[model samples]
Target: MDYRLEQDLLGDKNIEVSSYSGINTARALENFDLGGKTVNLHLIKEIALIKKAAAMTNKKLKFLQEDKADAIIKASEEVIDGKFDNEFKVSAFQGGAGTSTNMNVNEVIANRAIELLGGAKGEYDLVHPLNHVNMSQSTNDVYPSALRIAAIRLIRKLSTSLSSLQEALQIKENDFADIIKLGRTQLMDALPMTAGQGFGAYAKAIERDRWRIYKVEERLRQINLGGTAIGTGLNATNRYVFMMTDIIQDLTGLGIARSDYPMDITQNCDIFVETSGLLKSCSVNLLKISNDLRLLNSGPRGGFGEIILPKMQAGSTIMPGKVNPVIPEMVAQVSLRVISNDTAITMASSMGQLELNAFVPLIAECLLESLELLDRSVVLFKEKCIDDLLMDKDRCLENLENSLVSATALVPYIGYDKASLVSKKALSSGKTIREILLEEQILPIETIDKILSPNELIRTHISGK
Candidate 1:
């Protein structure tokens, strides 16, 4: 492969001749080569967007030449459009609070702009990375602002995925609306409820979490884009500071605005913490819903077998015809990982000792990972499991009939002591409460029918009716 020489404060290094990145990115490659991990490309694109917005604003203010700014914007737009993905090599877990990642983007844009201007790559004389591309930004503000934009983009994706999932689950709920099933408390049968009730609860949780994600997105709209270095807007003009955010909002079509106190936005990473915490809530909800599906689909003959998940794959090589709830299982595992990521982010958020969080790279990395993981997991769960879910009506009714705990429904009418007597007799003789009640002539047949109806029971549970 052909190579070109590039220089930074640390001196020169050999970079690939065809590469857009220069010395700083090369130094990052040498320093932070931990398992070939790199910053997410979405984040790099966000950084590029920041560069484009700043350059356009600077050009308007005459802080930068229009030709140079146009070239930089053109180059930055390419990165934002997902070109030169291979140029960003800085690891997600790195030192310098993401300066390496920031410089990597700056250099890639600068070199690409040089090429756009009919100059050779790495020829900073044409469009220098720091002097032109990074004219009015610092790693501190730029990195956090980029992270916020990246997160907003991701949250919108997650919200879309979740909305689809919730709608799919609601469809299943409606389809299963009348299917009577035995509800459980502490893993034992409790009372009669429609399968729809269970699925509706899952849908409700997702809807609630989706709203939470929207709220967090609004919180992240507060950014410190032009707060150069330490949030004082040092080394950047006021016009650039104010106009840059407007340009960014216009470009991204997001509700991003300049922070009221750039120091507050720069010195703290808690907004990310709060956003990730909401993501954690989403993970927990998925865990609960998936675990419930797994349990319901546990066995054909021995386990609950109340519902059948789509046969994604055979459960075991040894166990013939053993299909598993693979999609829900996948969701459960992803949820656990998201929970772990949130914990790490909480610790990383507290790592800010002064005006900057040195651990922001990890925070950004983990947040993006969790978002992508959940977004894909939810879509997969919906398509592979919920979309094709099938209720075992016979099994559900059988379980509902055999559940001794159904005696609780009778207690409200027959009194607890008498219901307990009826329950004991049914348990001893392996009979159902319906049978015992009929033999005892405990109440009118109409009352017994009304008492055991799943819809009525669910309504009573929900509305105290």
Candidate 2:
């Protein structure tokens, strides 16, 4: 309960003596108390990194003394390494165009750096938050730049998870390659295909998403770090602007660049919108693939029953013995959340005003949340679902035999009108297409068997023969 008094433009506020944050963080804590959520730790960490880069650049430019700059650098690195996670308490949905959150980082770094210098916590003469920690940077520039860095880091995780998921699906594709099943359109049996082919289609979708996310890293790399208040680079020297960005790149090893137009980077968040759109695209694909798996894994005895999903848990207490496709169902729900987050991000990005997007904290929250959800969901799905995914070969073949879609294979051999009539008759008679053809002596018994074999159907679809 011990506290120290710290001052800002709004005047003095009491902050915890042991806490890393100062009066700005104190005011932020009071201002954003109505909400339950706090600023993201990922953002806090990135801001610390930006501060560390600024401290180094300022030291190199002789703008700051070595002892103070070195102390600030060490303090900022500690935050980057997750030393003070509980210190940042500002809400993610705050006012001030992310200034509150930015200042919180400044205050925390300032106080921690003071401690590093063996000075009293509230002693600003040794290391001031605004004058020392946030030197040559503004919330408008630092928040956006740090957001981009966080996104790049998150995207890399998502991309790697997606790659693992894709590889798992590819393995299933090969494992199910010989298990022919009925393919459906509009929820009705339409044609014949191997379960491997179906899984391969999902693999391809994930592969494309991985490529899209990889490309987004490059777009996200360009930022407006030195573009002080409104992208004017005001108060920031040329050396600081140039070297700060390079130091950041060196620190993180990301291909980040200072934008030529800091104002554009300041006022517009369309890159986030575009990046969110890519996440939405991937989520949509996941939704489709997950729902497809759920459907294919529908029933052991009642539903389409074409395939069996891995049963991670018992489905219900009263159902006697039922196992659900819980993993795919969980993945589907996560995809829905990601898609909804994308909509929120798009809306928040569109509301940016004359100089800076005031909704950046929300943008960062939603976008990072989406990326985290995708990365976690895709990885869990790969490990719990796709890795042990097994196709019900006998069930797949049985469903194919029962479906009148084999009539589709006969379309080229017997003509569309005749195939339609044959399909209708087979459905009405509850007979297989081969049986009907044999009963009618159409093309003789041997030819009918050759035409109706699963391999022949796949080949015919491929070659149109």
Best candidate according to TM-score:
2
What's model 2's lDDT at 301? 80
Residue pairs in steric clash, candidate 2? none
**What would the per-residue lDDT of candidate 2 be over residues 1-465, giving only the tens digit for each residue?**
998887767777777788877777777777788677788888889999999999999999999999999999999999988888888778888888899999888988898899899998889999999999999999999999999999999999999999999999899888988888988899988878888999899999999999999898998999898899999988998888889988998999999898988899999999999999999999999999999988888877888787767778988999978898988888899989988988899999999989888998889989988888899999999898888877777888888888887777676678989989888888899887878898887766766777777787776353233
Residue 185 lDDT, candidate 1, scale 0-100: 89
Model 1 / residue 223 / CA error / Å: 1.5
Q: Distance from true position, residue 31, model 2, in Å?
A: 1.7
Global lDDT of each model?
0.89, 0.88
Candidate 1 per-residue lDDT, tens place, 78-179, comes to: 998888897777789899999999999999899999999999997888999999999989999999999999999999999999999999989989999989
Error at 337, model 2, angstroms:
1.0
- Give the clashing pairs for model 1: none
Candidate 2: where is the Cα deviation over 4 Å?
A: 460-465
